[model samples]
Target: MASLSFFIPALGKEPESIEDKIQLAEELKATDFNRFNELLKQVEDSSVNLTAEQHEQFRFLDAYRLAYSGSQTQAVANLTELVKVAKSEKVQFKSLSVLLNILIISRDYSEVFQYLEQYDQMQKNITDKDLRQHALGILALVFNQTSQFDIGYFYANKLSSDAVDGKYACFGMQFKLESLHRLKKYDEFDQEFDAGVATCEAAKQPIYSKIIQSYRVERLLEVDPNQAISLLNSLYQDVEQTSYNVLITLYKTLYSIAYLRNEQLDVAKEYGLSATKNIKEDDINYAILLLYSTLYEIEKANGNFEKALTYHEVLVSKQKAYDDEKAAGLLAYNIAKANVEVKNQRIALLDKDNELLSLQKDLYEKEARQNRLLVLILGAILLLATVLAYRGLTGRSRFKKIAEYDQLTGISNRYHFNNQAKIALDYCETNAKPVALILFDLDYFKDINDTHGHAVGDWALRAVVKTCRNFMRNNDVFGRIGGEEFAVVLPGCQTDKAVLLAEICRDAIAGIDTTESGKHFSLSASFGVSGSDNSGYQLKQLLADADSAMYSAKAAGRNQVATFSE
Candidate 1:
């Protein structure tokens, strides 16, 4: 909370006190680059001095601004400076995460791997709860993207089990599902695939759930190509209900499968052209290539041999770009070297500071003599060592707790929830008191994401979580098990009371807004309540019963609650 202005460069005079400077930075007009650059120039020309921590924060914000402004390459250059000065695990981890994501978007895979290797080291050093968990999630995703399924699944499960928040746990579950699919463990895949689908649906993440379903088609195709086509056709209407971008990709894929089946030629032509038209030339993902490939087939079918040949060449060229091993490894060295340069710069700065202090002592403290100077230098070194040691101890404790809670929503994760709930349930059972469980799932969340986009969907999720916390007290335990699906354990509470609470939450969520930036939409959730009598409490049974009840609420109409009945 201290003023962070020491980080900003001053203008002509000493910059405003740290608080004013930071407040001014926060108030900058986000869209007006002219005003933004004017503020930056004033800082760059400022006369103010800065602490190392302040300077690091300033530089991090600066690079982030550049990335936000779409100057990604320059952002990378700016971020490189921060990396060089990276003494703080939190700062370095944050910077590396941003840089890696930008590189991924730029398809700078070579450098992504290099930074990833460094990221592994940073994640280990991180004790900050928020940063550590976020790093774990990012690490899992990056590894999954790069085809490291085993390692990906490990981190995914770690994030899911360790963090109980919705989005983060959902991502972990999604990664686990993908990793399992890649490993070809069909039995495990089948078991998790449904959960994955449910989470995605509960969370209103249609695209991800559809991808999970698509894997089943891939597996089906491996066994029977014709049947696979039939399978996709059966799901056509559902797939078409997705957002335009996702629907385009699905349609293109379906066109290819239909072509294989030697059926739906007209349908293929319709979808191919529709997908191709919707796609811009700059879109270079695999889906775009498939669209072109499909176009090649459609064109050939129409006797447009020349056009078909042209499309074929384009498709091959796009495919070859991916096969270009040389390109993938191109930037790995320079980007990795950037990490090393950071350590080198840190050492250089320390050496330079020490040299300056020694000179200053010689020039100004001659009367104080060499003995005093010697003690001064030695004392400073010892003090620095002491501070580092203290930080190390404190940081580890924070990191350990970070591992037990979801970073996104700040709730107990599945792992922690299980422990806490068991204790609570046992206490209730021993006292012969009834206990209740409430499970809530956001209704049609995917539509919010598909229509309003992910940011709004996220806002809705946080709103629901926050609302749940407001309605429940300290005695209750809440955790997010599936995406968009949350559970609360109310020890010594009966079904009637649980149902009342669930309805309260349901109505509260229904009143919340979806979007955050400007335009807004309403959101709602379905709730299910189940209870255990004086006999005992079993979490698994409660969850299953609650899920079914919740499903009934969803069927009857969302934004309502259903209680388990005999």
Candidate 2:
């Protein structure tokens, strides 16, 4: 058995003394096997007098340390025992913190939240700002990992606000900025970044200064690659010897910027390979996919279609994996959108069906009434017959009007568009001429809805559609495709001509002015063009390819035109 040495707390600091020893034990337990063994040796060498409470604290600490530094099997056993012991008495704050830390480090986010609730309850009587800040910081991490950005932002902002002080404020601000970034509020993101930088500077905090500088590099990648590279060079010089997490982040940032700006295939590939090598494979999948995707784009631009396609396939797989969770959100949104569309279509169809039924019923009623009146006035039967014929003609005309056009825009409805597209496709197939399709979507249309209200969004969408219709050729088929998206089928147009025409349409739509709530705004659109290819494509494929191209345009920067190739 090893002899244990202990430091005694001062006479008056009984509870505080016990707390300090427990905290130390928790921290030691969090250390690695070697560190825990070293700590145990130190404990055995020191002699300290402890009261009943202090003895309990030491026992709990020892169990926790054993769990923390032990194998998974041993850790669980020790933790279970410690929990049993701690539960019998009132749980202390120090013990809870240690348990929570272990849960977090183990990535048990679900349990972390449950522990956080208990921690909050424990803090009810404690008014210490430091403890509150610590609790909130832990809570922020929990919310962030779970994609609860709003709640995470709330706690992080509370911790960062001027009400808090010192290092906690800096950590809170960093977390808040991260939450803002995730939410895609880029303008607000920049504001938060600047504020964070200023706070760190004012506090003279080196850790936060490094963190902010690393974030700056990330932002700089969006707008100016050269500036980002220059900043990274300076940062590397300062932290070249330090193998810290921040250093890893900075290296990844540098690699990303270089990969984006470098035009030459060999150079870009070289840098990308270097980056992939430098970062942990599992940690930076998004960055890795981005690199590969960019390289693929470069290859495609250079006309290496086969190589581009290969990289694209890989990129698609990685993107699917990345978007697996968001896939549900997107699918939910799409399903809701589709359901609304189906409902509207069903209503329209029902209205038409009902109108026909009503008209026929009215005609039958009129005829029956006429038959009755004819019996009374035999001489006026001719007049009644003429009146019935006129009503029938008018009813037919009204049904034609309803079937031929959309009620809202007076343009062709989807039924009309589909019929026309099929006819045009048949014509092109017979005549051996090319037909093209252009798909357009308003960029950030949802943001407009969120900011200016849905009514304004609706008005803006209608205005854009109206403008798009005005730009269409006489023979072109155009119709709205759900909210803020539209499709144009151009018969007798080749790929090159379709590209030029799509650009014209994109520019025209971008120039439209929309006003809502006394504020004037301009909107841009992404355009995707697909023409007849020798690969024997169907209408669905044409539409899908064009939509893919449009998304690419949006990704590259909206208000741009992209033509589907291969």
Candidate 3:
């Protein structure tokens, strides 16, 4: 909570020694930028002679300054090298912590977790009392941010119970309350809130105090509007004084939501507008969604349905973009991890080669020509085994891909579809979000297969898939569920939007160009839509209801969209 203090010494003034200067710099690094610069100058003075470890410490401090001062590129480049080559364990630990800090700021969570593993391993060798407390505090905060609340709660307790410093204790309590809030330990959170805020106040950290209060405000929004408004109003001055963009935005958003619920339309509109203007640059997606969502509610309450619809559309667009960005981050993280595994495997193979070479050398020194031949034969056999193992690995990977996707259309097959749909539905249910399912199939697929050949029918299916894919969001689940039937699961979609999307797909199907399949026949699909609002979040029930609706559409006429009704 003191900003990457796992390897930083406690603050002290008037340094009389190099160690004292380093300690003082660590103290001022996060709080007082100008003083940190002056301390850097004194450390870099020509008359002062510094040891190798001390020099590394100075570099660490310099990188910290660069990172906080908008020169993160150079800071990361320097810290990365220092993490590898620093002679002192303290400096190396500090480098790793700062590197993690930079990664977190950049929202490169994958690398943060990767480096977190390294930090976890290094913690065993670290013996400093303050450093251990800081490490626990950092772990608690990071885990909480990443939504690993149970682990965060565990570490927060450790940090708080073991902390000797009041500041560290306050930090531990702050994050512990955060974990409880996210974990939905409501009764516990209510019990802990006052103590957490009091501890932060005792430590003279109004910022942490404000953060704890914001959590209370968020909880109160669901239960007591007036109390939530009162808390938000009290929180406004502290948040403004801190000038922290994230807190400022959160405070305003909560204030607006509170006022909207309390029937103060003008005040809600004012704060909603102000909140949007204060969104942080690094993390705009989630903030924008929150701001727009509150504004949408406010507009709807004011009976300005058109403005509300516009805000709702903006909310949808922002959510899609956020989902895409999250997917890309996961992809990048997986790629990075895979690269590391490949490098480690290569090193392992080289080690085995070295071991084999040593055996061959031993045989040669013994002057056993026959044994040398035997060793060479064994080496060949080992190489053959390695090749076979590699083939087996690749073969399994190929089979896995085949098992998960429809061979003809390259979308999820029935089994994988069911699994993925369930996961999506579960997530939506957890968040109390709506979901909609669209079940459709070609109107006359059997007729098409009989009139033409299976080749043309297959081409038609693939074409339908391609057309439908265009209308789906990144988070939407599309799959081939049967011979001619397909399903699309749209999270956060209500029935009207689902029906609209189904109608669009139906039209698109009717308009598909048969020329691509080298045929001149028409195409059509019957669509059935069912949403959680009517059918609940169970996939089985949704699919069953959509199926009934599809048959109803077919009985009425072919190539029509039908919504599930009582």
Top candidate on lDDT is: 3
lDDT for 461 (candidate 2): 69
| Runs in model 2 lying further than 4 Å from the true structure | 1-52, 63-92, 123-129, 162-165, 198-208, 239-241, 245-250, 262-266, 281-566
Q: Write the per-residue lDDT of candidate 1 for residues 210-260, one digit (tens) a residue.
A: 677777876775567677777777766676786557555755576565654
Q: Which residue segments of model 1 deviate by more than 4 Å?
A: 1-51, 220-247, 259-262, 298-304, 325-566
Worst 10 residues of 1 by lDDT: 1-10
Over the stretch 220-259, how does candidate 3's per-residue lDDT look in tens digits?
8889989998877777887899887777888888888888
Candidate 3 versus the native: TM-score?
0.56
- Can you give the TM-score per candidate against the true fold? 0.48, 0.45, 0.56
Give the lDDT of residue 301 in candidate 2.
Answer: 67
User: Which RMSD does model 1 reach against the true structure?
Assistant: 27.4
Q: TM-score: which candidate is best?
A: 3
lDDT of model 2, residue 288:
58
lDDT of each: 0.72, 0.65, 0.83
Q: How far does residue 217 in candidate 2 sit from its true spot (Å)? A: 3.6
181-249: candidate 2 lDDT, tens digit per residue: 778777887878877877766765555556556666777777877787778777675444444543554
Q: Between 2 and 3, whose TM-score is larger?
A: 3
